[model samples]
Target: MFKQIVFLKRNRIRKKSKLVKQVLLLSFDFTSLFYTLLVIGYFVIAIVMEGNIRNNIQDKIISIEAYTVEQFWVILTAIPIIYIIRSFNQPGVIFSTAEYTLTFLPNTLQQVWRVVAIERWIKSGITYLIGGIIIYILSPTSASIVLLYIFILIGLNVLMTLPEWKLFQQHLWLKIVVLISLILINLVNLYLKSSFLSILFIAILFLINVLLLPRTFQQIDWKKVTAASDFKIWNMVMISYVTKIKYRKERQYSIWQRLSFWKKPFLYKKSVGYNRLWHLYFEKNIGVCLKLIGALFLLLFLILFIKEELFFLAIAFTIHSSSTVAASLFNDRLRTDLVQMLPWDLTLFKQTILKWIYSTSALLLLPIIMFIFRDLSVWTLIHVLAMIFSFLFLMPIKIEKVFKKFDNKASDFKWTEIFCYILILLIIISNIYLEFLIGVCLMMGIIPILKKAEK
Candidate 1:
């Protein structure tokens, strides 16, 4: 019976592999190929440059190494958490036709659950292993520490699939316990100053996780687990480059529906009108902005108190953020069906959006500026305002035009977009008044362009 189950599971994996290959071929395009090569080139360059990049001011004032280890880890941890939250909110799970065929097999439920748990562990191991490799390359941590971390993560991943265990999710106390345990382990390892003891502790934890799994597996809620997991698999398959294919857009939640009355203030406002609608849209999705702003604040705090060498990078990030918020003002509003129904005068609409973008940018910028730049001159202030206003007016139009060109294609990072972002950063830093004038003139061109596009 076990042999049959193993054979069926292997067969399922092979089938999935074949399906993934077909999907990849179907989604392949010259543009996607171009972007893929560009990303590969970028990583190659980054790897080559990594050693030369300096954190200290004497090494090179404006190098990428200006970002500290703590900053990098914060950014890294935030991304997975955000992605997980997004996945949960917009589940795209679909029931597979192949699952019906599995019913003929004996003890199908038990076999299926175990197979799934193993598959999840393998997937998590791959992810953690890649992260470990990146850390090994980038950090000064000893190989032992890196290996221990990776091994512990993999063991924890397996433990998470224990039939009744909920992982570090859905249970606040479990999450706290896990977090505290990790902290204590690290603290003990730091104090002990013995690598052997550290390994021993890690092994003990791994054993505990392994021993608990059988009991947890017996208590597992298969139906609930499968229902949640199926959506995750479907979503991953649809978005993955190895299995990219168009899927129906996930249902979107209204801002009100997503946030309770107490929590809604971060993403809600009392306002009405076409002119005010853009701001309302921004408010509705302000959580993303808040997160970005919080990160920028952290960057600024680090630059001021810890490492002033990252000043250029901080400015670059600020400008990049401004451009992103500006771009969002159009992307969401343009896609919204109700935008057409609004009593929009194109001239007024352009002015309103431009102002809205500038306000959002300033909201993000002022604190950073006040905190970081102590010797702020009027000229510097004017230059910053002029540069941001230019970006506020120009970036959305450029993004809208470019996005329209690739509207049919999957939205993935492209080098062309990166170049545009680099251009925005350069424009901000150049401090050339005539360049700002040119940008203003470019804004005039987009007005008529947007007018025609809207019509």
Candidate 2:
């Protein structure tokens, strides 16, 4: 049955890829995106602790040697606790409509359980594998430590998620007990401060859960499975999609309407062209800006206090985020009749200025962290300037004329911006003498071009 599903998936993917190629061949560059992700993966795996970098949690200036023995386990210990908390919010034994139908086939209940368990283990294993690789990168010791962590994580993923099963989920006490047991075990391990004892406790906990799964699986609630997966609603949506019956474009504002800031401040008493543009920017993007700021705060804490190695993740994040927000600044505003009724040249100029403001503002944290942690050198200075120029370049020079035509998808600068991103990221990572000179000249040239653009 699994083999049949796999074959179907492969055939479906082939057709989808053909359709995507026919549609997006001119608008996208798969190669540039692949290389960009490769660069990020390289940084994530290659990070190492060089010396006594300042850690915000341990000390203002703690040695990596000390942290290796003491605080390294702290990060590892929190992984299971995070999983426990997150599992509570996850859906009950989730199965798609397709998978739900498979249960009615001529298969025993044990066989069904076997297939679901195997598929889920594969999916969850991929997730845990990535997590383990990240922890390995962050570990100051040998790879054996991370390997044990990964093994424990695989078992714990099943154990922790068991609470979401019908037997445990309906009876709140069982769920609470499981949550407390896992949390207490980890907390005790922290107090004992012995790696051997921690591993022993985790192994015992994993065994208990493994023994309990058979009994729990016997009480499987098939109804809850489909309900959790929104089986009926999904079928309706598919039917609507196929029959060309479009859903309503409007979204309810009940939740957001209550937030004081969701209601815009008094920007202008009267609605002018600039006011309209400002309104449009906030109307569409303010929620994203606010959410991003909140996420960045958490990321800032992790990078500063938890692991300075995660600074590499921050750079990759900022590069992609700054480019995305900058490029999208004018997409919705200029693509429609939004700017048509307003003054064309002046509105274009205003939107460009707003792009510069928002993009530069989003990236202020990266440079700050860079200068604080890194040495105050000329290359560091050049790197920061290069990033800013590349961000500015992401907005095509010919954007003034785009989106004015009937064919909205005629704009094909997506790959050009992607190539610019790849070039800038490569230059930033390989900040050598030759690259530094090239970056300087590139920025110098871009400065005039941007000035001409503004004028």
Question: What C-alpha lDDT do the candidate models reach, one value each?
Answer: 0.51, 0.54
- Which lDDT tens digits does candidate 2 get at residues 146-232? 576566667666665554453323433454466656655555565566777666756765776777676666655555555445432
lDDT of candidate 1 over 1-455, digit per residue (tens): 45654575588678767776677667778688999999999998997677554333224422333443323333322222332333332221211333424656665655655554565677778998898777666655556756776775665444333312434123333443454455444434443455565556546646766786556445443444444444444454444644345443334444444345524434432232455576567667678776776687567656754655455456666666656666665666766767746544444554566666556455445444643355477645554554454445345554545354335443323433444454455444444444554554454445444544443
Model 2 ranges off by over 4 Å: 8-77, 89-94, 124-141, 158-168, 171-189, 192-200, 227-455
TM-score of each: 0.39, 0.37
Q: Candidate 1 regions off by >4 Å?
A: 1-8, 20-115, 122-150, 158-228, 231-244, 247-307, 310-313, 316-336, 344-455
Residue 408, model 2: Cα distance from true site in angstroms: 57
lDDT at 432 for candidate 1? Answer: 45
Which ten residues in a row are the worst by lDDT in model 2? 53-62
Predicted structure 2, TM vs. truth: 0.37
lDDT of prediction 1? 0.51
Ten-residue stretch with the least lDDT total in model 1? 86-95
